[model samples]
Target: MRISLDGQVALVTGAGRGLGRAIALALAGAGAEVVSVARTPADLNSLREEGGALIRPMVADVLDASFYAQVEALERLDILVNNAGGNKPMPMVDVDDETLDRLLALNIRSVYKTAQAAARRMVAQGSGVIVNMSSQMGRVGSPRRTVYCLSKHAVEGLTKAMAVELAPNGVRVVSVAPTFVLTPMTEPMFANPDFSAFVMDRIPMKKLASVEDVANAVVFLASPAAGLITGESLAIDGGWTAQ
Candidate 1:
């Protein structure tokens, strides 16, 4: 059966490219009016060209405090996809103050701020869904990923906290944790044969996730079909965490 989000409004962060762009397109395909937000206008322009009238491109950095005002300004936000975040792999000892600060600001602080703004509106309306873009690294650990893992762990914790608090108000908070999705950001890693093999070896499926794979999960979590799923991190990890 097909999921329908007809008449709903969705706000997707980092919608310029990669997984975020895919999620924005998926939402539009499901009939939601999608507000695609990203710092780059060109990416949003491409999204608009592809998604047509169903997609509204908005240029903004999710890290900006004023961005919450834009989110709060949405008169009717049915769904919020916090997909904006960045990562740089470094050994635990090599991780500097600046790197840690940047990761926390982008991954944890921005997500928390955006969620609060969206949750407030959802509480007022008495219903909404929030899907955060986490990572399989959030569930498990890896070398040189301490910072990324930490941020995602915080995301999971915050998701649970918000889920419990907002359930009474008809808002559901959840996260999607996918393994090594093949995106522009990750192509460089996959370009190295040894690193690519290492990633493949970790997954029982021996394959990386696709943009559509994660996007499908996001669409489901954002839809009414997943009405009862909350306070959980849905892993699209290709069995990597099972081991």
Candidate 2:
């Protein structure tokens, strides 16, 4: 079946590049008016040039409390893709206090705050969809990614909680958990042949998730097609999580 977000308004964080950019483009292509948020102006500009009127670029750090104000100002918001997060891979024993704090702030705190703000607006409007960006690590543990895994595990829990609380208000909350996708954020890991091969070996499909793969899933979750699908994490891991 075809999914269409015609005339819908979607807010996608981290839209400056990578999967966020892909999701923004996909949403726009699906006829949604997209509000793309990112800290980098260049990436936002690039998206605007490509998406034109359908994509409205907004430059702001998701950590900023005012960011929610900006989202609330939107005339109407139907979809929220909480995609802004980062990870600094390191062994749990070697992880510093500061690094752990930063990861928690970016991955968990920001998601909770942003979703809380969006859910408030959505409850008033009486309908909405929230897609939190998670990772395969969220479900399964990984070496040198303890902090990242913990943050995403929290995200999974938060997604379920939000879904339960918002369902009564006609708002659905879900998460998209993807295996290693080739993106600027992950190029460093893929740069090492051994590391790349090790990653590929874990995926039964022997392929990494693509930007389009995750973006398409987000679109489906946000579309009427997934009207009843909430409080769940859709794994786009190419079978990595299955292993």
In candidate 1, which residue ranges exceed 4 Å CA deviation?
A: none
Q: Give the distance in Å from residue 76's predicted Cα in candidate 2 to where it truly belongs.
A: 0.8
Steric clashes per prediction: 0, 0
Best by TM-score: 1
Candidate 2 error regions (>4 Å):
none
Q: Ten-residue segment with the worst summed lDDT in candidate 1?
A: 132-141
Model 2 lDDT per residue over 1-243, tens place: 668899999999999999999999999999999999999999999899999899998999999999988787777999999999999988889999999999999999999999988988899999999999999999999899999999999999999999998999999999999999998778888989999998998999999888999999999999999999999999999899886
RMSD of each: 0.7, 1.0
**Pairs clashing in candidate 1?**
none
Model 1's alpha-carbon lDDT is: 0.94
Supply the TM-score for candidate 1. Answer: 0.98
- Please write out the lDDT profile of model 1 over residues 1-243, one tens digit for every residue: 789999999999999999999999999999999999999998899899999899999999988889999898889999999999999998999999999999999999999999999998899999999998898888889999999999999999999999999999999999999999998789989889999989999999888899999998999999989999999999998999988
lDDT of each: 0.94, 0.93
